[model samples]
Target: MSGIGVLREGPLHAAVKDLLARPGDVTEVKYGRYVIDLVRADGELVEVQTGGFSPLGPKLDALLDEHRMRIVHPVPAQRRIIRVDANGEVLSSRRSPLKGEVWDVFDRLVSFPSLLAHPNLTVEVLLCAEDHIRAPEAGRSRSGRRRRDPGERRLTEVVGSEVLASPADCAALLPDALRAEPFTTRELATAVGCRMILAQRIAYCLRGMEVLTDAGKRGRAPLHVIAA
Candidate 1:
C-alpha cells in the first residue's frame, strides 16, 4: 500500500487515477497515519475514490486543515456488461439500461456532506463509461442460485465532469426556484424533478456546506432556506 496505489487497485480505479494524475504527481505517499493516493508537485493531495465516501471522513479530517485536497469520484454514466470465459475471451457484451447521473454523487456525499465546509476541500465528479466484467464461479447466491456477482469495473471513457468547490457551485445543482426559496425536501424533490431521497441528500449537503439554513418546519418536514 505504500507503493503506487495503481499497482494494487482494480482496473477502473487504476485507470481513473492515471487519468487524473499530472506529471510530477507522487503516487501513494504516507502522511500522518494515512496513506494518501497521491500528492501533486504543488503539494496538493488528490484522492481517487471509486466507491462510497463514508470511509474518507478520517482522511479529510486529518489532511484538509493543512493541505489542499481534491477528491476524484467517478459516476458511471453508462455501463457495458461484458461476460468473459475462463480463457478471458469475451463471451457476451450488452449495455445496461440503468444510467448514472452527476446528481447521483449526492448518494455517496451524504456521509461526509459537512466536509465540504473546508475551503481547501474540493469534490470532482467524473461522468464516465465503464465495462463491467463478470465470470462464472462455483458458488451459490443468497437465494440458492448459481453465483453471478459483479466483477471488475474497467474504465472505457470519460464523458464529462463537474466540480463542487464552493457553496455557489452546489447551489447551481438546484432548480432556480428551490435555490431562492425556503423549501422542504419534498418540495425540493418536485422542483428539481428528482426523487425525494435524492432531494434529501441534496438538501443535506447544502445545509452542511452552509448554502442552506434551518427555517423551522413545514408540516412534519424540516424546511430550509438558502443562505443570504
Candidate 2:
C-alpha cells in the first residue's frame, strides 16, 4: 500500500487549524485516545470528529449517552448509518438519504461540535459522499452503439466548474506539438486528464476570459490556443 509522505506544514492544514482556533467558548478536549474539537454555539455544545466510524462511533455514542449531546457522523458515500441510540437499543439506522453534494455534508459535519455542546442540542448525522465518485459508463449495445441504462444512471450529474490550472499554468503544461499550434478538444483533454466535454468547457471558459483564442473549427472539432 502507498504511504503518505510527511511535508512541512502548509495551507492544506488551514481548514483543520482554523476550526481548532475558535474563541473562548470553544475548547479542545482529549478523551481516551481521541481528541474532540469542541465549541459552544448559541448555547449548544458542538463536537467535531474525523476518521473512520468503527472506533469513533462507539466512543461518540457513549459520550452522547453520558452527556446527552446530539451526535453527527460524516461518513463516506459508500457507508450507511448502522445505528444511533441513547442506550444499547438503536434509535435509528439506515442508508443515508444524502448522496452527492459533498459541501452540504461537510458543512453539517463541521457544525456538529457546537450543536453537541448545547444544553438542549439535538443529534444530527451528516453523511459525506466519497470524492471522485465515478460516473457509470454508458452501456454498449451489440451493434456497437451506446445504450442508456436508467438503473445505472446516477441521481446527481457532475459538471465542469473551474479549470484546474490558470491560463499561464495551462500554457506551461501543454505539449510542444500543441504549444506550437492550436489543438483540438480531444488532444487537450488527453493532455489534461479530463473528459472531452470537460476540456471543451475549459476551452470555452478560457476563451471567454481572453486567456485562450478560439482558432475556428477543424472539421467538426474546435481548435484552441493561448491568446497572444
Q: Which candidate is the best by lDDT?
A: 1
1-228: candidate 2 lDDT, tens digit per residue: 111211322221223324334465444445565444454443334543333223445556546554534333333444334332334344444455554322222233232322223344343333333222122445698999987432211112122111212235334445666677888879877776555665665565455445577798899977887777
| lDDT string, candidate 1, 103-220, tens digits | 8888888898877767999999999999999985548868899877679999999999999987788877777887656789889888876788888888888888888899999889
**Where is model 1 more than 4 Å wrong at Cα?**
1-7, 136-148, 215-221
Q: Which clashing pairs does model 1 show? A: none
Please give the lDDT score at residue 205 for candidate 2: 47
Q: Going through the candidates in order, what is the number of backbone clashes in each? A: 0, 13
Candidate with the greatest TM-score versus the true structure: 1
TM-score, cand. 1 vs. native: 0.86
What would the TM-score be for candidate 2 when compared with the true structure? 0.31
